[model samples]
Target: MSAFVVAYFPHLCLAFGGLLVLCLSMARSVPAGFYPVTAGLFAALPGLWAVAGPQGGSPIACFYAGLLSVIALATIGLLARYAKRRGFAGDALYGLLLWSALGMLLLADADDWIMLAVGLELASLCLYALIAARLDDNLGTEAALKYFLPGAMALAVLLFGMALIYAASGSLEIAASLAAPGPLTAAGLALVLIGVGFKLSLAPVHLWTPDVYQGAPAPVAAFLSSGSKAAAAAALLHVCSEVSPEAKELLWPALAVAAGLTMAVGNLGAVAQGSVKRLLAYSSIAQMGYILMAAMAVNDGGGEAALFYLAAFALMDLAAFGAVGALSAEIGDRDDIAAYRGLGYVHPWRAGVLAIGLASLAGLPPTAGFVGKFLVFGAALSAGYVGLAAFGIITAVVGVFYALRLLAALYMRESLIAHPAAVYATGPAATLALGVMAAGLVGLGLFPQTLLGTIAALFGGA
Candidate 1:
């Protein structure tokens, strides 16, 4: 029990921390800045996994779980400022965030079917509520409904797939079930892929992402794009890595097609967006395609590439969305591209942070995103996925155009807003959080070896 608690300390903190925040809400007078402080504490609690005792969980899961915590902490930092301004920084929102983080951590460590199912539901439900937390916002509520209904269908399909796989293999372990070769297993894996595809916002099933991201609060969108998607990607990586060669042969072509389509759709979608949030939403979708492309080459260093990209992708989205959350106009988010004209002149620091994020997203040099792409493309080529790598490169170049559009809006154009001062200035806490993301992007880009080496070492690559 002691070891179990130690192993799952991060999980425990998220679960209990959520309840504690809800309890605190009943107090007559609570400390100012309490929620963010509490959130910071919860985020820090996961570090105890290394310090307090023996590590009890899979190292990969622990790493991903810790990453999720950081994402949640950053979301809260932005929320600390964004929510209050929008009149929705209730204790309930904070509590839900912790609980949702709990689910993400659970998914990171889930080695069996039931645990995976539970984590998926917990995370999805909490996300629905978080999206609609702004009771008065019709768009938020509508986005929640769109996500919730489709999500429910996806979960049902996933559970059914699990059932079929279990029946075929008589095993609950992810690897064991997937390793079984049969008609049942083939069908089951296909269904499961469909479910995961929807969850990950893959092309053809990604219709929900842009509207939802546009409707959800910017900070919540940040969490959705970064933490939730990272968790899903981690789980899918585990699934892909476990498949039998027969299973791989069955699903390989489908996955490759999806990867290409997702990249094309996402980049093309971004090019048409007039709203920054929608553009970021599309960009996030495109990043997932790159992950997929790298994942196909897991044996040839693609797993490490995917892991590095996931980490880099999360930081990039957080910085981008957090910047948007910080710079909302008098009424709400400045979603329109025209709204950000001359933002660099008015808020140099915030705009610069956004530029770093976009540059990274564009896979430009001296940014984490660029390093991530290099690793991904290298892995793809090493695995003999030459055509896919070339396609990804082309899509990446296309992706740069939209990011540059946003960058031009920030610095080149004159301020369109009459009262630049009226725009919500980012609070210190949120600014600091965005700074961390920007620094991480550049730091990882410049020193890619540390992370690449660490991932390789963890997976016994070197």
Candidate 2:
């Protein structure tokens, strides 16, 4: 029992943290910052243990669990001011966030179909409620509804795929099921891919992302794009690792085509977006395309590259959306691209952080995003997916334009909002969180080996 508790302390910690935060909400004298700070501190414990503690799990699983914890911490940091200002700063919101982190941690370590389903649903169900945190807003309600219905259908499809796998393999193990090849296995894997693809916002099934993101609160959008995507991507990479050679031959081509389409659609869609959140939503989709390309190369050094990119993406995305949340007026989010005009001067620190995030997402050098892209492309080329790599490079170039467009609005354009002064001011919480993320992006870019060396060591020099 002690061994079991030690192995699973991180999971137990999160469950306890959620309840603790819920109970703390009952106190009348607790400071407004107490909840987010307390939540962040509790969330950080798992990450700290995963990073500095003994490793009993695979390096990949440890890395992902730690990554999810950091994501939770950073999100709570940014959520501090945004939550207080938006009137949603309470135990219920923090409880949902902590519980969802528990789910993401589970998904990151899952090795079977049942575990994956449970983790995915646990994470996803909380996200649906979080999106509608602003209960009074019709847009929030609609966004939650849109996400929930599609998500439900995807879960059904995924469950059916799992059922088919059980029929073929007569076991619940992911490894056994993937290694057991037949027509049923093939169809089952295909369905599973479709279901996961929808969650990751890969194209053809990614129609919900933009509207949902635009309508959701900026902090909530950050959680959805970063925490949810990271867990799903990590889970998909684990699944890819378990595939047999024959199954790979069949699955690889289909995944490659999907990557290409997702890259094309996401970059193209982002180019025309006037809403900042919508643009980031499309960019988030495109980022997944690149990550998917790396996932295909898992046998040939893709695991390390995928890990690096997911970490960098979570930082870049949370920083970007956190800045947006910081700059939002009490009335609503300053979501319009034009609403940002002259705010660079009005709020230099927040705007600068936003710029760093955008530049990194555009694959600018001296940033983690640049190294992540280079590593991803290198992994794809080395793995013999040259066409996908080349196409990813091209789509990446197109992605740059939208980032530049947003930056131009920030720095070049004149004030467009009727009262730019009415925009919310940045507090210590957002500043500290965004600053850490921005610093990490540049630090990793300049010293790519900080992460690269870790990945190499973890995989025995993969």
Candidate 3:
């Protein structure tokens, strides 16, 4: 029991913290500033655990859990600020964020099918509520419905796949399922991949991402793009790590095709979007495609590359969305890319942060995103997926054109209409958040050796 507690302490802290916050939210006449303080404390708990908690799993599991904890805390801090600015009251939202973070932690440490499925459902349900928390917005409600329907279908498919695997292997352990080979097992793996593919927004099944991101609140969209997507990618890595050589022959080719198509479709789709939020949504799809190349590699080096890239993507993407949220509050039109015309002249700090984010997203030099892409492509090439690596490079170049469009609007174009009365207003909290993330992105890009060495150790142990 002590060992178990040591291994799973991060999950326990988040779960207990969530329940405590939920209880506090039910009390009447709470103090004015209690929730934010409590939120800071809750966020701190995970970071502390990441440093001090006992590590008992495989090196990959430990690395993923630590990374997930850090990302979750960063996301929660950003969401708390966004929620406060939006006049969202009560501790309920914070509690749900903690709950979702706990679910993600569970997924990171999951060693068996049951735990993975449980974590997936828990995180999905909490996100459904979070997306629709703004009940007054019809678009929010509609996006929630759209997200829920597909999520529910994916959950069902995942459960069915697990059941089939159990029947074939007579065991529910992930490694055991992989070791026991049969036609049923292969079919089950295919079904499971399909389900996870939807969550990760792989092409063909990625139809829901843009509409949902465009409709949901910007902070919620940020969480979906960063923390939630990272968790799903970790789960994919966990399952794929156990694949047999024969299974790899089939799975690798399928993943390669999916990665190629996802990159192509995502970049092409982003080129046509008029909404900043929608464009970022499409950009995330392409980012996921790059990460999937690492997944396709399915080795220690690949896992390291995937983990590093996910961390980089989370910071840069969150910074981008944070800038968007701040500007949306001022402009009142979250969807219009045109609203950002001449923003660089008017709001240099915010524009600079957004530019850094977009540059990183485009894989420009001296940014973590560029390092991540290099590692991911290297992993693919080393794993003998040279064709996929070449295709990913081509699509990444295509992505730059769309990312630059937003920058062009920010710096080059003149505003077609008069500015709103609130156009100059800025949220200090959001700005601070973006500044922190932007700094982190630059720091990682310039000094990546520390992180790379840490990842190398973890992968070596795995």
Candidate 4:
């Protein structure tokens, strides 16, 4: 019993915490601060497990569990501040966030296709509710409708793919599905990729991303962009790890093309966007393109690169969105780039963090984003995808233009309107979250060798 407990403690911790929050949510007079406190405690459990040395699953699982914990904690922190500012009171909102985090934890640890599907649906459903939580906004309702329709379609595709794999191999285990390959199995794998691609916002299926991000609450968008996206990428890495050589021949080419298209579309779209939230949405799509490039390499080195990049991207994205959330809370959700005119002069600190995040997203030096792109492209080059690597570099340069454009608006452009009676102010809680993420971005960029060595060792052991 102790061994079993040790093996599954991380999942159990998150699961139990989620259930506890749900129960509290049902109470007639739950404390105003109860949700954030419990959620923060839940978020700490996986880090505690990490500190004690994970005793279950592979080292990769431990890494992902730790990653999920960090992302969840960050989300909870941002959500608490957002809720406080906007009077967004609801125990159900906090409960849903915890439930979604639990689902992500489950997804990261899934060993079989069935578990993967369950986790995906669990997270997806909670997100739908969270996105549409603001009952008064028609735009939120529209975004929820757009998100749900495609999500349901993706789920159907995933289910059909799973059924096909089961029929072909008579087992739902990832290893079993990969061990035996027939035409049916190959088709199943393709369908599965399509489903995962939708979740990751890989192009051709990513139309929902910008609209949803633009309409959803800023804190929710931050969580969606960082935590949810990282969880999906982790699941993609797991699925790709089990692919047979026969399957690889079919998968790699499709992945390469998708990567190129996703990068081009995402970067070009960001350049055209006038809204900060929409711009970040497109930037996220391009970042996923780079991650997919790493996935195409299909080896342990590739997986390590993908995971490292995901961590870097998560921190950078959270920093960017946290600033957006703070600004929106103060400025009445006027997320237009024009609203930010001369912000660099007025709100220097917040603008500085936002600039750093955008610079990092552009793969500028002295930020983890640079290191992440370097590792991802290096993984591709080592795998002999020279043309694909070149394409990625070109798209990355395109990404730079838009990022700098945003910075230019922050510093160069003059404000067209007068300041409101209340000056723009970021709360201490939100500021702390932004600072932590920025510090992480710089720290990871400056001293990545230790983390890289650890990732290498973990992969080697597995």
Candidate 5:
């Protein structure tokens, strides 16, 4: 019970913090930016503290709390510019974001059927409200509707699966249920996988990715990409790992198919996109394909590989999003690739940071992306999944072309259009983030032995 409370305190703190902020916001007309900013920071602190606590070193159950802490901080940090520029001034909005973050934390740690459902719903409801927070705009409302409808259906599917698992095992606990999942439990697990698959944007169930990513604000998209998706993947990995070894055979094929198809579809779809936002949308889907492959690599050191890649993936993504935030602010929210033409010449610092980020995403040398992919590829080789591993490497090579294309545009001949003198200030926070991410990427790439050693110690054989 103490362990449970210790593990669960972050969620409780978030709930309390959100409610307090809500009450305070309603009491008076605070400064336009005060509510959300304060709430966001306050909300993040609990999770940070929790993750850094003594018990965060759990082995097999994974770093459920700590991973979430990194995610919370990253998401909040990525949204700094977006929140600042948009003037998300309400207490409600901040409270919602905080609450949602807590919910994500809970979802990652869910070990019981009821807890999973509750946590997921908590996060989903907050997101629905957050999406619709764009006051006086029907478009935001429409996006929220699109998000909610499918989200609700997904939730229903998840709940039904949970119920079926419970019925088969006569236990709500994940460990007990996994001891022997009969046909009913297997079916239920499949349904739950579908539900989580939706959250992570795994096809053929990922129809909502483009709409949600495209329609949502930049920060929201970042949050969805990092926090929400990370939590869902964490939960899925936990559940699948806990299930019977025999059941894993049943699961891997589905995940493998989903991974391969999503990678091909996402990358191919991204090829023609002019909007950076849309391009990133497809990029995220492709990234998820890699993540899914790592997940499916359970027997073949998949778990360790997945964990390694997730850390690297989070860093690269946040860096990328940070660049986009700065770039968007520089050009009045112009997300078109055309606006990025010759960006290297005009905004050298931003372009450099973005280049580093793209390089990592492309899995090029001397970046965290390379190390992460190497770990996964090594795992695949060790597992003897030669074909799957080859496919991943090939796709990674293809990704290099698109990533280089961005760099080419940035550095190619300067655009004739007058460059804006006042580039969005890559203010202190952005600079700090970019620097930290850049150093980490380079450090990990060059001296991967240290990172790999840590990963092996933490996850046992990476």
Candidate 6:
């Protein structure tokens, strides 16, 4: 019982924290500001700390739990920052975000098929509600519908896969079942891959990502990209690694093709978008391609590379969207690249933050994004996927072009648009968040060995 409690502390915190927030909301005295979010944040800390602490000696430090901690913190930061200006469903958002994070943490550490299935449903259902919460936006409603329906179908496929696996192996524990053998088991694993492809936004099945991200709130879109996707990737990596390799020979090639297609489609789709948020939505798909490439390299230092990239990716992506979210409040929240025309003069600091984010996203030097790319590409090359590595490099270069468009728009001139005296009440918190991300990006890039060494050690145990 103690072992389970320690392992699942984060989920417990989220559950209790969410209930408290919901009660406060219903009482109609939940404060008109960021207090409820602050309370939630405070409540969730023990769980986050417990998970982050090197106490368990479990070797595998629950990737889903750690990722959820990161996401929960990021969401807390975003909610607190946004709560002051727009009082739109802040309490509900906070509670649901925690609930969703709980689901993610559960999904991440799931060692069995049933646990994974339940976790996936919990996270997906929360997201469906969140996507539909933007009452005034038809786009939000439509996106929720589009995402929800397909998501349901994907869940069914995943459940079916689980059933097949159980029938073949007579067990749901992934590690144990992987040790068992049969052709039916192989087919079961293949079906699982198909389901993962849908959630991970791999090609053909990724048709939902762009529309959903474009339609959702900027912060929500960022969560989907950074938090939700990272959790899914982590789970997928575990599944791939623990499962039998007989299917890997066939699976790897298909994933590689999907990675290439995802990058090509994501980048190409972004090139024509007028909206910054929409462009980012497409860019996200492309970036997922890069991450997927690393995932495919799992047998050869790929997991470490993937984890490293996930951390770097989350920091930079969140920073980008944070800047967008902050500015959106001022400029009609449209986040069109053109809307940012000459923003540098009006909000120099925010523009600088945005620039750092974009440069990092472009995989430019001195940013952690570059080091992340190098690690992934190196892993791919080591695995003899040289062509895929080359494609990643090419697409990364192409990404720079789109990222620079923002800088160009900013540097041109100051528009007549009035700079709203923004009340980022937790100015220090916001600044600290950006600084942490920026510093991590540069720090990891410069001294890549330190992080790699740590990750390598973890990989040994994983």
Stretches of candidate 1 exceeding 4 Å from the true structure: 48-54, 330-332
lDDT of 5 by residue, 17-107 (tens): 7887788877765675566456656655554654354354244233545555555555555565566666653457667777887788778
* Candidate 6, 358-416: lDDT as tens digits: 88888899988888888889989998899999998888888888888878887785565
Our model 5 lands, by Cα RMSD against the true structure, at: 2.7
- The local distance difference test score of model 2 is 0.86
Residues 135-231 of candidate 2: C-alpha lDDT, one tens digit per residue: 8879999999999999999999999988998899998889888889888888888889889899899989999999999989888899999999999
Clashing pairs in 4: none
Candidate 2 runs further than 4 Å off? 26-32, 330-332, 418-423
lDDT of 1 by residue, 190-297 (tens): 888788778789988899999999999999999989988898888888888888888888888999999999999999899999999999999999999999888788
Judge candidate 3 against the unseen true structure and give its global Cα lDDT, from 0 to 1: 0.80
> What residue pairs are clashing in model 3?
none
lDDT to native, each model = 0.86, 0.86, 0.80, 0.84, 0.74, 0.74
Looking at candidate 2, the ten consecutive residues that score lowest on lDDT are 416-425
Each prediction's RMSD over C-alphas, in Å, is 1.6, 1.7, 2.0, 1.7, 2.7, 2.5
Candidates 1 and 3, the one with greater lDDT: 1
lDDT by residue for model 3 (284-403), tens: 999999988899886746887898898899888888887787677666654688888887777777778888989898898799999999999999999888999999999999999987
For each candidate, give its TM-score against the true structure: 0.97, 0.96, 0.95, 0.96, 0.90, 0.92
Q: Candidate 4 lDDT, tens digit per residue, 1-462? A: 898888778777887887888888878787878888897898788877865665866565677778777777877777786766666666678778877877876676778998888888888889988888788878888888899999999989988998999999999998888778788898998899899899999999999999999988887888888877888888888888888889888767988899999999999999999999999999999999999889887574688789889899889888898888777755567989988888777777778888989989999999999999999999999999999999999999999999999999889999776645336456565677788888888998999886777676666633
Write down the TM-score for model 5. Answer: 0.90
Residue 241 in candidate 5, Cα distance off native in Å: 0.9
Clashing pairs in 5: 297-302
- What TM-score does candidate 1 reach? 0.97
